[model samples]
Target: MTPHPAPQSRGVALFDLDGTLVDTTYLHTLAWWQALRRHGHTVPMVRIHRAIGMGSDRLLDAVLGPDRETGEDEALSDAHGTLYATWYDSLQPFEGAAALLRATAARGWRVVLASSASEEEVAAVRARLDADDVIDAATSSADADATKPAPDLVRAALDTVGAEPEEAVFVGDAVWDVEAAARAGVPCVGLLTGGTTRRELEDAGAVLVHDDPLDLLRHIDAGPLARPPAPGGTS
Candidate 1:
């Protein structure tokens, strides 16, 4: 019998789950709004939407003002978490989400999830995706000193797998994600599955953009996820 070839070992593939893999961007926006309202803060949904990819510690500062009372930070973050947890069961992965992950794994890439969310939140998202078998590692808020747009989480993800910036590419759907990838010196591939637009992502440093995970999966060969050139060789 002809022997099957070994799986092609590409570089690591780091992913941001919330809006990039699952359809939770708007849900998070609504949750943040409700949480803020419950705490007597009235942040607009638009502002909250833009802050979705930021960590809870940074969200308030981004949407609200730096002048906000520092003491209320934990309470506000707790409220948001409490409210967001209610919709956990309803969270769903985007079309071809699991397939995309599995396909990337099949290419022998070390797949890791990089999220600024709490451990529970990240677990919920992973459960929704239901593709943990293909996932090699994950780094949540607890694993990082800071969050997106800071490079902490991205660097943590890379450290989890002992990968270098050039040996991996980040896939995400928000400007913060792009910024984080850039700070980590890793190229970013943006997806519009989140509410972020192509122009915004591009301006933030995404090397390429796609409509969603499925779209990216379909174009992987010709897209940013394509295998890099061999050492000392040009593509």
Candidate 2:
């Protein structure tokens, strides 16, 4: 079950961790590929890559098919988790990830890590980034009913930070992230660092896109994150 969220805050900057803040896109693809193969399914890495942002609950169907046996889902998820965990000690944050968070926080935005990753994984990534001092709060899979493209996680993150959707801007690296933010009525800024193309993110409704955290930091004042929070939580 998902946990109850804390109150909201103003001028929130909600961020996706995996492909947005850390360099885990290909690592996740490889882990999923290995897990699928373990169950005698041999999906290609490219197909897995495209489905990277979806939670494990939805990813198998996205890469495999809806008709796939439901019984194997848990096993597959566990396999992928175990496989992915092997790299926890080696996970690295993208360049300027911490600085970006600090800058956003310095500008009065409550920085929150809004990711679909498990809390353990989120913590690992946060440790690697070493920027928790500036991050006000975070929401993981345990805080949402669904993952990206569903809006549940994004909405949960907003609630966790006490920010209305209109008071927040989401930064992510996947089309699912943009779609999720749109569903939550928050503007999204897509990052190409997650291996997703700018065209894909923009088409999914991202108001702006940047190459990485550094690029966004360089132009923070000129982008969606710079928008002021709505007065009195109007919407």
Best prediction by TM-score: 2
Give the root-mean-square deviation of each candidate in angstroms.
Answer: 4.9, 2.6
How well is each residue in 1-235 modelled by candidate 2, as lDDT tens digits? 1223332436788899999999999999999999999999999899999999998888888998899898999999889989999999999899889999988877767888888988888888888999877877888888887777899998888777567887888999999999999999988999999888989988999999899999998998887666456666443
Candidate 1 structure quality by residue, lDDT tens digits, 117-171? 8888998898989998878788888888787789998998878766678778899
Residue 218 shift from truth in candidate 2, angstroms: 0.7
**RMSD of candidate 2 to the true fold?**
2.6
Query: How well does each candidate superpose onto the true structure, as a TM-score?
Result: 0.93, 0.94
TM-score of 1: 0.93
Off by over 4 Å in 2: 1-9, 233-235
